[model samples]
Target: MPELPDVEGFRGVMQRCAGGRRVDGVEVRDAGVLRGVTARRLCRELQGRRFAQPWRHGKWLVTPSDGPALVWHFGMTGELLCAAPDDAVEAHDRLLITLDGGRQLRYRDRRKLQGVRLAADEAAVERILADLGPDARGLDLSRFLRLLSGRRGGIKSALTDQSLLAGLGNLLADEILWRARVRPDRSVRGLDDDELRRVHAAMGRVLRSSVRAGRVPARRGWLTGRRDDAEPVCPRCGRPLASGRTAGRRTVWCEHCQR
Candidate 1:
């Protein structure tokens, strides 16, 4: 699944390929990936409008134009790609927006799971984001602690819950917890202040590195790199890693490291 870092990478793609560019055409090769708007309405609303600066919040990417804003939620298999108009469209290229120049922006998705939404204005965009909690990347230590303080669940569950803290997915949650030496099934309330602070700092570090790499890097020293190994072990310690489900998502942690 495309998580926060992946979505941020797509935001960079949007800014580079379509920012401030005039829309020459809108093509909906597969309408199954659209939400709350029909193919005809999408073309009508965005055909001639110029795209403004694109931004991202949590896992959502927003491309604002003269009228409505295009909101993208890349579910499990969705991604945005930049290509030349003459380039061949891939099997999953569901939507394409041709810019004024030679570039074309493609919305490609294999699962077609959460797709696109057309927000009529800034207010509409807010309505779409209202359900989400504060973005994880922008949270400070104080706010991060506060957000976790009120939630009652396993630490991993709180971390991955969009209503509690947006942007973290299964991989990030596991990685952050591992770095903090906190177990996936540890209760939020059971953690001491020091543990919470460690979690907050770990989140910041993980996000910074992931954003720079444009994805959660599977570096040799990182848990993400070894999670799928034949017999995964902790990078910090040689003990074997353990796996289970938390918050309905697969979670991996080091029992010897995380307490």
Candidate 2:
């Protein structure tokens, strides 16, 4: 899944590849990936307009122009790629945009679970965005503590809950809890003040570091690194990492390190 850091990286790609230059053309290769705006309307609305700086919230990326904005949600296997005109097309390139300056941007997704939406105005933008909680990268410790104080779900589940705090996915939730020394099964409200402090600090550190790296690095010394091994071992404690299911996704944790 393309998470916050991944979306942020794509935002950077949009800035470099499509910003400033007028949208000479927009080819909705697969109308299945577009929402609210038809192919003709998309081309008409964006064809002559220039793309501005893009913003992201949670896993959603917004590219605004003078008219309706293009909002993208990269589902489980989606990505935005920038390439030259003659570059070979990947099999799943669903939406392609051509700028007047000759560069091209392509949105590729194998499973088109969620795609694009066209928000007509700032008000419409707010309608779609109003429900998202504070972004994880800029989360405030005091506010996060307050939110956690009344939750009954497990720590990992709470972290992955987009309504509580946006931008965290399965890998990040597990990694953060592992670093905080909290078991995935531990209820959110069960955290003591010290434990909450540790969790807050750990989440901040993990999110910042991963966003800097442009993804959950899955590197040595982190749970993400060893979670997929045939017989995964804990990178933090050298103990065998356990795997099961939680929050309808595969869960990874080190029993030795996490309480």
RMSD of each: 0.8, 1.2
Off by over 4 Å in 2: none
Q: Evaluate all candidate structures by whole-model CA lDDT and list the values in order.
A: 0.93, 0.85
lDDT of 1: 0.93
Best-performing candidate as measured by lDDT: 1
| Cα distance off (Å), candidate 2, residue 241 | 0.5
Q: What is the TM-score of each candidate against the true structure?
A: 0.98, 0.96
